[model samples]
Target chain A: MALKHSVSGFLADRYDMETATGFLRKQAGKRLPPHTSWLHVFGSLSLLLFISQTITGIMLLIYYRPTPDEAHKSIQYITAEVNYGWLYRQIHAWGATLMILAVVLHMTRTYFFGAYKKPRELTWVSGVLIFIVTITFGFTGYLLPWNQIAFWATTVGTESANKIPIIGEWLRYFIRGGDVVTGETLSRFFVVHVIILPWALTGLIAVHLFLMRATNLATLEPVGEEKPIEPKHGIPFFPVHVCKESIVAVLLLAVLVTLSVLAPWEIGEPADPLVTPEHIKPEWYFLPSYQLLKYFEGPYGAFFGIVACSVPFLLLFLWPFLDRGKHRHPKKRPIAVGIGLVGLIGALVLGYLGHVSETEQTFFGTRYHIDHYGVPHRVADKSRDEGE
Target chain B: MSNRFLGNTEMNEPTPQPTRRSFLDWVIGLFSAVTVGAMTIPALAYFWPAAKGGKGGDVEVKEAANLKPGESAIVQLQGKAAIVRRDASGLVAYSAVCTHLGCLVKWDGARKEFLCPCHAAVFDASGRVVSGPAPAPLPAYKVKEVSGKVFVSTT
Candidate 1:
């Protein structure tokens, strides 16, 4: 008892620990909506995946060489030689993909439940920014391995920035740090991936979480429905909500570990600027936008495709205002629900098309054939082999 | 007086002990704690830095004479497959990792080229992609022949 008293006294003297504990307890005691369930756990799961990615990424940075010549070689060393290095790298890689997936799930849940309306506009906007930051994280990290696919995909990915009207070329040069993808590009991506992205993402996520806690989670029931009267209707954030989130995080970790163990991440051949791969495709999450661009014809088409695809984010940002109804239920908002479904199906279909690339078409008297491997080869080119 | 402070007039009656609700909470709380601890430990260990060592030193593949003219032997070099071939020109060692995706490539004697089963990417005798999806030639390692013994260095 004396020792306990002394420890408490020390904490109080040094840090005024009682006040801090009271503040934390107040925050933790906040009551969540009674209707919260498994679906509500996705946002926390995304945060968990983000933390996992950051930890594993830091581990990889210990052995990862950022220069073009040594980047791929260093990855090989980490995967093949270092202790549990393969697991670390695989977790980081798969964590990125899973994080994006969880973000989508969370966003869809929010939108369908009309949680973005009123008092939560900033929260939704911040969530959209988080999504963009997450994808940008994926894009910048894709080039770090300095492998064939990483090089070519990054080249193509950044080239899209060139499709902008006036500042296009300048933006591309600024991103690449030169006219071409070189050592400069690798260093730039490494800095952005390791330093800039994590800091920005953490700031945005903090704001998002702050706004969420301040506003409180939306109930699953519509606004007109009666709020439960009993004290048990709502749950405290400390033990109840936190424990549920913990369960979800554990499940997510299990999936990630299985993926990391069963199919460890592999680094492709070292990047050779002189040789471009026959089939160059960006990571899976970028496929929808990639296919959307292919539908258009020329430089102008690329711009149009980009603008069209980006319209959804703009709409999503302004959704609270655009969807000016007080209803939180889906049935009451038929048009919004319809549009959301259409957008989801369109994205999935476009992603599929991008993956298969098995389209042969004659556009303006030119025969264009995209093989199954996403390799675009001209049918009229007699010099090329028939099989590819 | 105690009931007033407790915010429940029914507290004077009696608090339930070992109820089904409390038991379920304990079960779930224990399970969650165990599962989360299991996941977090490995994740934290992965973040802890270990000794950094190079895996690129020279490795003795096989006897020089075993890799005869027009014959190729797939040898493991630091956990990656490598092909040591003796052609009409000279002895050359190439990484047997397919340039397309890092799948281990196999030496097809009849075809006399390395074939990747993952994607049909073919590398010719000198590691150049003759046909298929491979983008670049297979990476070649420095080969040294000393007293009928062959060694390859990826460094």
Candidate 2:
């Protein structure tokens, strides 16, 4: 219990709950939707991923600079300055991918499980928005390092935007802030990555959670049951679920740290407008787009690519209405669930394709053996000729 | 003389013993106890995570002599920035930090200077702030040779 002294007399607050038999008391004690299974862990994992990024990001920010000229050098200093600076960057880098993955999977799970049914539609929609924002965050962060791969990848991004016919050119200008990927682009991306997207997502998440509390976390009873179906599958959200999430999150962090320790992230060659990158690819999260670029032809390819990318959001936005089925079981609603699986697999395959060097196109065409993609690629053995 | 000695001494002075009395005294005593507890708890709690040291840094690059002559090395021994330098003497080590605004400096040997096209801050071999409005000089770390190995500080 907490005690507070009032102006006129002593006022006390009680932490204990009385076992009242009233209707309001019953509502207060009513258990939430029975999502006790591991299937629900991904949302918590997404939250954990965000926490990881924020922590790693703050640490990296101590070393990272926003200036176009000094940004890369500051990164080198972090690697060479304080201990484990590279680890900070690597963890955040990998954590961003994992964060995107976790949130996407969480949304997919919600869709497959029919958790987006009436009254919980906003939770699912906001979640989809969160996914898009996470990817946007990744895209903006990718260029902050300003390496060759980052440069060309962003070039691919901006140019792809320029293919949208009329608004395409304007949108590219809006995003890049001028003619091409220049100092303005870096500054603009910095703002979007560090401030804009995060602020927007934070508000969305708050509203999403409020709606979640209002909807009571959607229990696992039969959809049409009115007389209060069995509540045996339910569990308290705190000590039970939250505890598991903490453990899983710590373990995941440990694994990521080990990977970072074994192999730190490497910034490739500097961005040179004159020199073409040996072979460039986006961060793992954008493999699908890279693959899309490969499949499509010139300007039309970009337009089709944009349309392909935008379709998922449209589907996600309408998922609630489309999935108006009465069943929440895996046995039911096969089509929606199938779409989710195909999308996940498609993303994975595209990511795999992006990592392969043989099929990639590069100007010099000699970096095939340099840094293999897929996993986080770091610096190579340049002790003999680095800076030479 | 006795008063001076008494003022300095602890054994001679008489002190009052505790007595249960006024409500005001009791209230004052309670508030003081609460205040102390509040101050101590938060202070200790704040230090706990810091003490555990979740904050990690980079490994320091070792030895100015590891690379023979003008040989450059790309180091990913920690995580983010790669330390690329052909520095044979501790005289210089360029931060792979991009000069455009300190991303991660990369060396352009054909160009013979550090280039950060993000805003195009370039630095010469001396690690001096060569071109581009790099507000500060490239940091030169103190490294010594020990058993033929280079170590960078990542604390």
Candidate 3:
């Protein structure tokens, strides 16, 4: 008791500890809906990953040279020379992937629970904004490595951004800071990645959290019931919810570390503007859209492709208003659930398709020999270099 | 908040004792605790940078004088198994990572083929998959003998 008093006294002397503690206690005591499970952990997990990324990103920045000529060399120095630099770099890279995934799952969970209806509309909107910002962060960060894959992937990524009909050319030029991806583009991306996006995302996240806490927590049932059910006893946010959150964060961090240790992130050959790789692919998160664009050709195709890709985001943003049915149970909402399932399955299929090489087939012997690209060609007419 | 007829202690119901439900709870709690501990230790270690080893770059596997015709040696090339074989033609090196799922491939001297134990995928002397579920031929690395030392470089 004496030790606690001294520590409390010291903290109080240094700051407004009492008031801060009171505020925290009040926030912790907030009543959270019952039936909270592992599905609800994604938001906190994403936040944890975001925090990890921020710390590791700052560590990387100390050694990372943003200049085009020096960037790749600087990265190599960090990986090969700096103490624990490889760990930090791998954590940051893997963290970004995991953060994106967590955010997606969190959003999906929100949708599944119909948590976006009515009072939570602003929170949902802010979450969607954060999702966009996160993806943008990924797009900007990919080029910082300044490797061959990064260079070509950025070129392909920006080229696709150029397919946005009227604003296509301007958007491309704006992103690159010139007609081509050169030193200027690198500088622009570096500044945006390190400074601009972080600030914007932080501000947006603050608002998101504020909105989330300001409203009552959504439950399994839809709001606006004609005959209200008996109010269920809510669990306190402090000890109960916080304990679960900590457990999830710790487990996730452990998993992230294991992955980092097992497979240290690879740095491909340094960027050579003169050469484009035989096959270029963007980061996996963007695969669905990339695959979508491949099926279409010409200006009209590009226009339609852009529209098709935009539809999901549009639907997501407008979901609360779109799904106005009284029933929140997934079984009762067949149409909504079916649509979500289709979108998920389509994304998965497209993601897989995007990573694979497309090859044409030619008639061969009964036991046809498949080529490198999975294309079959006749052994009788096999050329010296038929497929890649 | 007073209950009626509380004085009649003999009529009161007996308090429920712990049952199989409590036992199940204890089992789950113990399992969860173990799982959490198991995850935490390795995760903490993973944060530290792995020790640097001379594995990935140009690694000298064997001496040219020691390896005769039809002889093979499994060398750790960049933390992956690589087989260096000396035949009548010259020295050849093939990646030991199987094409199917990256299981380490083993050299079979009698059969003269590289075999994956995971799924029984087989690669011939040239690192081409002869049978099973492997999708692509094993990657071949360039091998050079300089001053009687065989150096293998992964391209």
Candidate 4:
């Protein structure tokens, strides 16, 4: 007790300990808006996933080699040789997928609630920016595995920039660090995924959180309307809201562990620039865009495809300004809700198409071959002849 | 003492003179700019991708007799992907890097075409774009057959 008092006294001499503790306690006691629901957990869940990713990513980095020559070999070593290295790798991989999912869900919730209105415009803008950065994090991180899919997907992903008219070629060269995806490309991506993107994301998340705190969570109140939160009437941030977040975090960890244990991520064949994989598909998140780009062919197709893909992102970023509606409820704003649904459905359909493209699959009784353009063509079933 | 530090006449006159604080500010500004430039210039240069290694020279693919007709071998020419194919006419070579994207095109000996797997872009035996999204044909390289050995020029 005497030692504790001395330590506290030493700290108190340099800092206002009482005031700091009081301030933290006040923040913890702050009340959330009355309308705050279970749906709001997604944002916190995304944060949880990001934290888990950072921890796992750091652990994986201990053995990961950025060079193409050793990248795949290092991953194999980590998975098979090192103890629990596979667990860290799997958690990081699953964490990325879950993080993207959580971010999308959070954005969807925010959109449906019409939370991007009036004073909360900046918050919405920052949130959208964060979402874009998060997607980019996924894109850059996908290539770190240095596998066949990583190589080809990055090839296709970077090559898509070649449609940007005059600067396209230079841009591709810049992105790849050369004429082709080589060791240099791997180095560049490793630095970006590990260093540049993390810093960028941290800054973006800080800004987002700051804006959200400043504006407070958007209630179901109409635009330009504010319902003052009362301490007794609303949910207390401490023990109540924090408890909910804690439960979600625990559940998220359980799911991540379950995924890591059930299906550990495989380190596929190392990247071969010379031998392109026959079926090179990007991660599921990029499927919608990948399928969409297939439709745009020829000289002008790439340019148009780029524009088509960019339109949605542009719209999403500028949504706060575009949506001049007074209503916060989905029922009140029919047009906005309809457009949102259409986009959601369209993305889902495109993703499904992408999943099935360049492959033969039997849906119901008919065997259909989905081509590069994601167009289904009925083909004669050959499975009966070679049936089990 | 103040009057002695600044000449008595100068102190009496209300002339605008550079203060020590302003002088220090200017020095700090210059140092800051120099410091930033010192850091930024190297960083900017770092992003400008490493230069391709080695001077352009003849890279030996294999023995001219080794590669039979309709056979192709992908080799590194001056640190870039290059393909050497033996045809009925003669030994021909082209940069294997696809014109559509940077994917290395596989030599389809049966079809006698260079096939890019990324976007299904096809190039004929002559490195001409036959179909698909490739805007240009694969660039040809000079193949020299000397002393029973085939060499692809990287210049």
Best by lDDT: 4
Displacement of the residue A142 alpha carbon in candidate 3, Å: 0.7
Residues A22-125, candidate 2: write the lDDT tens digits: 54454545555565567778887887788778888888888888776887888788877769887888889888888888887788777677778876888888
Task: Give TM-scores of chain A for all candidates.
Answer: 0.89, 0.82, 0.88, 0.95
The runs of at least 3 residues in candidate 2 whose Cα sits more than 4 Å from the true structure, single-residue gaps closed, are A1-35, A221-233, A357-388, B1-155
lDDT (tens digit, per residue) of candidate 4 on B1-155:
44433323455568645667666766887999999999999998789777655587788876444888888888777668888888898899898887765678999988989998777789998999898777788999898888888888877
Report the TM-score for the A-chain of model 3.
0.88
lDDT of 3 at A89: 91
**TM-score of every model?**
0.66, 0.61, 0.65, 0.89
Worst 10 residues of 2 chain A by lDDT: A7-16
Choose 1 or 4, whichever is better by TM-score: 4
Instruction: In angstroms, give how far residue A51 of model 4 lies from its true place.
Output: 1.0
Worst 10 residues of 1 chain A by lDDT: A222-231
Residue pairs with backbone atoms closer than 3 Å in model 3 (clashes): B55-B78
Clashes of each: 0, 66, 1, 0
Q: Is 2 or 4 the stronger prediction by DockQ?
A: 4
Model 4 root mean square deviation, Cα atoms = 4.9
Deviating ranges (above 4 Å) for candidate 4: A1-14, A383-388, B1-35, B53-57, B63-65
Q: Rate the local accuracy (lDDT) of all candidates.
A: 0.79, 0.66, 0.77, 0.85
Q: What is the alpha-carbon interface RMSD for each candidate? A: 12.8, 15.5, 17.7, 2.1
